[model samples]
Target chain A: MPLIKEGVLAEDNWQSLADEDNLVDGPIVVSLERWQEERESLLARNTPLGLRLRSDQSPALVVDDLERFSVVALEFPKFADGRAYSYARLLRDRYGFKGEVRAVGHVFRDQFLLMQRCGFDAFEVADPAAVEAWEQAVSEISVTYQPGADARRPALALRRSRPAVA
Target chain B: MYRYDEFDHTLVSERVHQFRDQVERRLAGELTEDQFKPLRLMNGLYLQLHAYMLRVAVPYGTLSSTQMRKLAFVARRYDKGYGHFTTRQNIQFNWPKLEETPDILAELAEVEMHAIQTSGNCIRNTTSDQFAGAAADEIEDPRVYCEIIRQWSTLHPEFTFLPRKFKIAVTGADHDRAAVRVHDIGLQMCRNEAGEVGFEVIVGGGLGRTPVIGQTIREFLPKQHLLSYLEAILRVYNQLGRRDNLYKARIKILVRSEGIESFSRMVEEEWSHIKDSALQLPLDEIARIENYFAAPRYEHLDDNVREFEVKRFEDREFASWVRTNVTAHKQPGYAVATISLKPVGKPPGDASAWQMDAVADLAESYSFSEIRVTHEQNLVLAHVKKADLYALWLGLRDLELATPNAGLLSDMIACPGLDYCNLANARSIPVAQRISERFSDLERQHDIGALKIKISGCINACGHHHVGHIGLLGVDKKGEEFYQITLGGSADENTAIGKIVGPAFSYDDVVGAVEDIVDTYLEYRTDGEEFNDTYRRVGLAPFKEKLYAAH
Candidate 1:
């Protein structure tokens, strides 16, 4: 599945299989190996760069490389390993990567909201109907306990002040 | 106690609904077990050996009687008529089905509670002084600061995925009953010479396989810099803590490797950059959080020394309970009463639904309707009046809650070892029960004098065996259960890591070995020295000599 979304794919399209070469010029997908092979190649290119899935990769390394590439894709090899979720969050907040994070893998409908909250903008869900469900999930909750790219003030900070009435 | 404002309540309510949807999807086969694992864990639900376990955060062990009763209802309706109080001050119910977890969480939400971040690699429950508000030497209620940390660390994005789980403990008392020294980060509240209250920060103390007492990183941190200092510590830990080895990933190893001086310098360097940022506590906001914990309207009460003494002399049982279970409160007329969960032959820290409801009722009647759960597995009513001690004793006796063994040999800190927890290697509660029975005589326990016997079913140390004065660590030798005894460990002001005695003992011989050690200490004691004093003065050598003499 694709980890980065570009002009080619829809806002909801995120999954990319290994070099199924299935690209309609939607987004520039960069695998960890591919990203490493052409780190300078992607940085010099005029398109958004993506990082594809590696089964035994740490997100910390990819997060460290964010300054060189604009768009980074974090692949979920089997969907059960949550090291990617932590990577997605660290990439967005700690490393200050403000580009699209596409979660592509055995992406299911259930994890759509949590993935989104952890800073995944575009999700490559397998089923077509799952994408629509994911869209609904993102706007479902208006509040969260954590502070990340989505919100700055923690859930408590807002409570310290009173609402201004017009 | 921190009251849930609109934001806090809204966040939990939304999370409940979100988890409800996640649960629905899982049930419909839209989510696999692998997919649902993290989601359920973030909500504090775990699929254990037999059934799903839900861990509800207690937020520094402060709870209203209403909250306690609600927990009792959850235990009665959804669980096996009981709940296990964990060392982190959270409560775990072991028998909820997968499908029923969302509903249980929804019920928990009604009382401003949830199981969020309890089991996840994210921030676990923030534990603090159980005697927070009413401690004699407290600068301010530690719960307010704990609530602040609770808000700051709850689902915090940057620090959530550390090398492993993180724990924090805070103490605002002079005596440090909260065991701050053994936490990942321990905060001790102290007033500066200028009369401003601040924290003395200690970093890298934890228990598991590599147990190390936290070293002081900051001698005295300004009150307003609390959050910022914490950010520095966590940032350092998150970036540098060893993750390649699961066993060596905790901050203790990092602190040990980096050494305290270098680690403190690094934290200071990080703090210098973020000192004036948004993370620093704004003066106004500190007041806002502190406002909730202002002392309740208390009437001037007469000092009941004569009345209490008269009652104690009148009844031997009341005197016995007062001597063992009661503690001096900061308030003139108040005393802290610890109701022991370890009655003889009962599982340690396991409270049944009826017993919980009874404690809730008692809290309402005698302790200003509040109850606190200690990490040591005892419940405290922090504000009991001296005048009402006799009546409280009688009421507690009726409910079988008055064990009169608080801080004594019978008040054992035990983990639900092999019987419940999948991580445990041996049965812990049975060993505790056997030991309690051996020391069931009140006179014997009284003679033992402020001794703590902590039992862990395994090396996970959920029973806090490393810090117990007389620690019993359960190990499996050739698939046979054996106990490893440690002496001189403590979690108080003078915290010392326990030293192991001779060879590991068989299951049947563990209690006898403990009795022999106590007998040895009694024989070698000088005047009024307690077990720890004697152990310190004579060293573990004498106990070891007595223990393995006949072997």
Candidate 2:
């Protein structure tokens, strides 16, 4: 692992990202510019379980394909570009995206915590040093809201059970 | 007055521990800012313009003296000795460091308070009439229903991440003080032909870009079907609200796009399907929640308040305070005293720690320890006895909390605009300050009568500009602040969004513009018509004509 700035992504140090036993795994995302014949051939041979999507991907390609992949990665073009944040939330909350949702590419470390809070369980931080940071981030809190898909019990559940409202 | 049972306490306790864990992870470098943002937001923490702000919900604006004292303690201990009460009946502590929010939230939970749903797209704090259980004409105590809705909406799985934030206000009076007409969904309690209580549900009323007074979707929705009907509305909004455009995502937009008729139809259809599910109100549950809000044991006293009136006439300050601050309570011996959080020239709704402590003490002594925060940016001590009014008034005056401007022009509702909020296009507090200073004369303010001047830094309408009797909207004219004034708007029984009067004014000239309008109203008003009444009878034509005619 290499040293990563507080907010900078660790994507460039992809080779240094080490995986551990029973750890969450993220799919390798081919850059939009690299999606060519050679990439297609490589993908076909490898048969990866999912594809990391970019903002430029045509909607026709992503919508209504229920069985196409186990996960769909949404790239954060920039931290300020909240379009991807909404995209990720909508994909899970509205589009019924159930598999390993990952936030990858050009993401700020600060944003990673929020992204995970919004239901993105996996991240592909592009730096080696960010791995420890990312790991530390994931374990930061336990218990979450119920309205969203997070694990925190909804406050309503904590309500005192009553007989009825006459 | 929803008493915190052990279960409620445990839930908030666990929430604090969870947030603490989240903080640890951030320190450990596990949660990146991207991952941590929503988590923090869910806990009512926000990284605003200067520092992180934590907004704690004073659910339905109701609080006990003990709870208010806790708020004061947190403000002094963690914040910069003060907190800002918001229009949603919540309080925002400015200057809370990111690291300290979990502890602050823990403190809040200790007082049976939490920041849950203060942020996020879920149902925010349910607002009710500040006069809720105490109003003279209230058919039922509204806070009881508000608490029920709060519990039902908390962690509502299906509607948590709706297209945008949702607000609900309930009122039990014919003269709707809760501003029910300007909410996403406004529920007003009414009695049926058989004397059975029910709700009149209004949908789609909101005050963002496209302000619309809610349309009555159901003239009489049975009280027992409250949750199911609300569920139906939420379901329809969730399934259809536009997710593509952030600005056009609130249910208001959907209501506009689908048209009220079609939107109501969809909600009705949905209700038909799930109205009888677990969401339906069981008679016992309503009774159980109502028990928490039952009228406190009241000492049987003389209904005639003649002695209190004589005493007030004797004391000039007390007389003025009673005239401006006290509101009629249904109980003959009691009155609701509104402690103005807006003290003349100070920022609207900013209360110091010491002030809060004083108010808490006053509440304990004078009002059976019950306090409420109004959406109009005031603190209300409900259930104050007329016999003890002088003592409470004297104590409040000592703390500079007894400003005789409960619903007066000086009691402005202004947002944390550019000064604090990153979303603001211009500053709102200074504008409010200037107006408050301009109308600092008490006699003149009384002559002017009840007028609400709500200012929103941007079109988000957090300050509820759309519902103000006179609304000031701040806009950025190429990085410089400009304000557009509106008139004839109101948020009570005759709720309507204000109409834009004329041209926008620079910040310096904005106060003059308001004065000009007020003068025009005074000059033309027939008899003792209020700002809203005059504007309505003559229409915005007179004010608008007066405002821009000279220009």
Candidate 3:
């Protein structure tokens, strides 16, 4: 599996740990349940920590520990479940989480642009061959109509073309 | 009536190119059907029973003669030379290759139209009163806000993939022509004691499976706070709305379960944070959108036109149409003329390419080149003058658009059932055609007076069966088509869900059952009471007795 960060394939150093499993040394990602249980113990160690959040989990859980984690992975249970997109926006816009926001599980080329617009800088997809497709998808629509976590200007920024009043 | 600006044009063209790539990838087996389904849905292309159905959004139901001509062109070029107008004020083409959709969308964008968000779970085409800018009782044109919402919701990053489809309807008048009460989010334009225009925000009203009327979260949201308030509602729903159960995922169920008070508090708290942010609509932007919908030039003719009066007296057919279809417009000389798509013994809301071209020509000549699509699946020439009524009537008559049955017995609302939609359990078009043939006489329909017979093939209620005066839900009973009848539903200011009658009737007996109900209404009604009013006045007893006795 390859991780696409900022529209390019990147080397991933973080390894995710299951909720019931013990946390290993080195850069590691953990689920919300494991983070809640092992927050102090993980903080005492010196490895970079990441949090894997399901769509159902709120970002407010890591409000104080946003600095402790270098990566925050939002889980898309399915492509159709869009709750994680809002979670990404909340992490970036509301909480001002400067760490790398990654999208994991059920992500693909079609959603790369939307996921990026919602401030997910890293996407962990199963297919390594989809990097080119993802690069094209992210830039397919240069113009946008809505403002999100990204800085793209809305179409309404153009002057209103109303008829001249006599 | 809005021509696309540079940014608008750019976005649509970009979408076309994007969809083309997606389709190419799909054909090459890079993307499976499961992956392509949502991608296709966002572009308003659907895999139906037979072929791909492309629904083009008619924004706020308003169209120019140019847009109308383009629709007719698409029908002739890509589809079966005809298109079906939907209850959401949209036009749908039934047959097109999945590969042809991008080209179809490109052509639509040439006319300032696109299929974006027409079928997705995202905020759908914002519907408004068909008579929005022309209606007499309107406080403000709802299309201004509708356009604002349209721009704000397009490709919205967060809310695009919700648990269920969301529909929003806005109405400027006191009478709910847009059926605001039954939508996912209903915006009613009203004035407060201070004489400032605002909205009465209603949340969580829907009809599929669990039908519930919306609860008012905001009593009066000022014009500027509209976007902020709506965003708050969406954010709350996105975080809290159930994704586990497809049936209970609508905002209505959320508002219903959490209690309106609790839901309102949550929305208010969310809104408090973002009220002053960039989402709050600026005054100039509001005025800019408002200016697009400003009143068109008008002629200063008197209200009474002797020529129109003479034609009505001389021609009974035209006069019958005037009685059922024509309504008073705000301007002195102009009148709103409803061209019924539901004629006797034809598929409702269907207009051929030639008929569409003829309508466009008529619009150019008579209605200042503007047309409207209504929630009742009818078209309206909203600014027709009194002097041009006869000429327009003759033009429509020649084109088979003069169906004198608007709001009458034969003017029924029906969904594309088993004939097209894959989700349907029974055929709705044949049933509607049979009923129309049963009451083919124009005079008989006029006598029945303003009865809405809404029929849906399945309980999705696309035909708005839950809101019809005589609602019919088509169900499959042991591999046979059986229709369950409901009585006294109205999707007006006084919105009420229809009650299910005694039992389900077979396909053959459904029409007779409706006839029995109408007969009962005719027998016991007061002098001027419509079917809905009469049914409300005298419960469902007489109709139930009459319908069940014959069975």
State every prediction's TM-score relative to the real structure. 0.90, 0.81, 0.98
Which lDDT tens digits does candidate 3 get at residues B134-204? 89999999999999999888888888888888889999999889889899999999999999999999999
Model 3 earns a TM-score of 0.98
Sorting all predicted structures by TM-score, with the top scorer first, yields 3, 1, 2
lDDT of each candidate versus the true structure = 0.80, 0.77, 0.89
Could you give the TM-score of chain B for each candidate, in order?
0.97, 0.97, 0.99
For candidate 2, the per-residue lDDT at B192 reads 81
Better of 1 and 2 by lDDT: 1
Q: Model 2, residue B209: displacement in angstroms?
A: 1.7
Better of 1 and 3 by DockQ: 3
DockQ of candidate 1, scored on C-alphas against the true complex (2 decimals): 0.28
Q: DockQ-based ranking, best first?
A: 3, 1, 2
Per-residue lDDT of model 3, residues A3-26, tens digit only: 988778999899898976666779
Q: What DockQ does each prediction reach against the true complex? A: 0.28, 0.09, 0.78
Each candidate structure's count of clashing pairs: 12, 42, 0
**Can you tell me which runs of candidate 3 are displaced by over 4 Å?**
A158-166
* Candidate 1 residue B375 C-alpha distance from true site, Å: 0.9
